[model samples]
Target: MENNEILLKPAMSFAVLKILPLIFLALLFLLLAWYLSPFFVFFSIGTLAAGWYRLLYIRKSIYLVTPEVVRISRGIFFKRTDMLEIYRVKDYVITQSFILQLLGLMNLTLKSTDAENPVIWMVGIPESDVIDTIRDYVQEARKHNRIYEIN
Candidate 1:
C-alpha cells in the first residue's frame, strides 16, 4: 500500500469501569422491582441489552494508524470514517483515569490541524506500547511529510 502501510492497528474497547455505572443501575432496578413485582425482570434484561449494545458498538469501531494518515471508523448503523493526515497532527496526549489506570488501559488524544475534527480520541487501548508506537509513528510521519512549526 506504499504510503498507506499500516503502522499500528489498535483495538478500541470499552473499559469495565466505563460500563460499571450501567451495571450498577441495572442491579438497582432489579432490587426495586423485587419489591414491586416480577416485571422487573424485563428491566434487568433491558439493562443487559443496553450494555451488550454498547460493547457491540465499541467492537465495531476501527482505528488504523499509518505513516501517512490516521483513520477511525465508528458507529454501528450510521458508520463514520474520520481521517487525519499525519503531517497535520500537532500534538498528542496520553491520559488514563484512576479506573483506567487500574485496568491497565489508556486513552490517546491526538490534536490535529484539522479544523472540523481537531481532537481525535482513541480509548481503551490495552497496552502502553501502543501509545509509544503511535507517538513514534506520528513523529516519523511529520518528518517524512516535512511538517514543522515555529513558536
Candidate 2:
C-alpha cells in the first residue's frame, strides 16, 4: 500500500443535508419553470445541474491522512486537492452538532502553518479511533521531519 494511503472517506450525508435547502429551492424553480415558458426549462436544468454538481462535489470529498501529510480532495467537474504537511499541522478541533452526536459523526478542522490552505475542514468523520490515529500520525510525522519549536 502507498504510504499516503487514504485514512478516511467521510460520509456525504452531512454535505447533502447541508444543501437540502438549496435543493428545495431548485425544486421550487422547476415547478415555477413548468408553468412558465419552455425557455425556463433551461433555467430549471441549470438549477438542477448546479445542485447535482454540488452533491457530486461533496460526494467526491475525501480526507486522507498519511504519515507526512493530510490531503483533501473535493469537487465535481472541477476537482481541487489540498495537502498540508503533517509537520506543519499545529492543531485540530472536532465539532459535532446534536444530531451529529446522535449519529456518531463529527467534523474535524485542522490548523496548519501552510500559507495557501491554513485551515482544512473535514465533516462526517466517525469520532473515535480515526481522530486518535490522525493525531498519532501527525506526531510521528513531526518527529520524523525533525520539526520543533524553539520556545
lDDT of 2 at 26: 73
Deviation in angstroms for 129 in model 2? 2.9
**TM-scores for every predicted model:** 0.80, 0.80
Please list all clashing residue pairs in model 1, or write none if there are none: none
Q: Show the lowest summed lDDT stretch of 10 residues, model 2.
A: 1-10
For lDDT, the strongest prediction is 2
Question: What is the C-alpha local distance difference test score of candidate 1?
Answer: 0.74
Q: Tens digits of per-residue lDDT for model 2 on 5-36?
A: 65665666766776777778777777777787
Kindly give the number of clashing pairs for every candidate: 0, 0
**What is the TM-score of candidate 2?**
0.80
lDDT, model 1, position 39 = 85
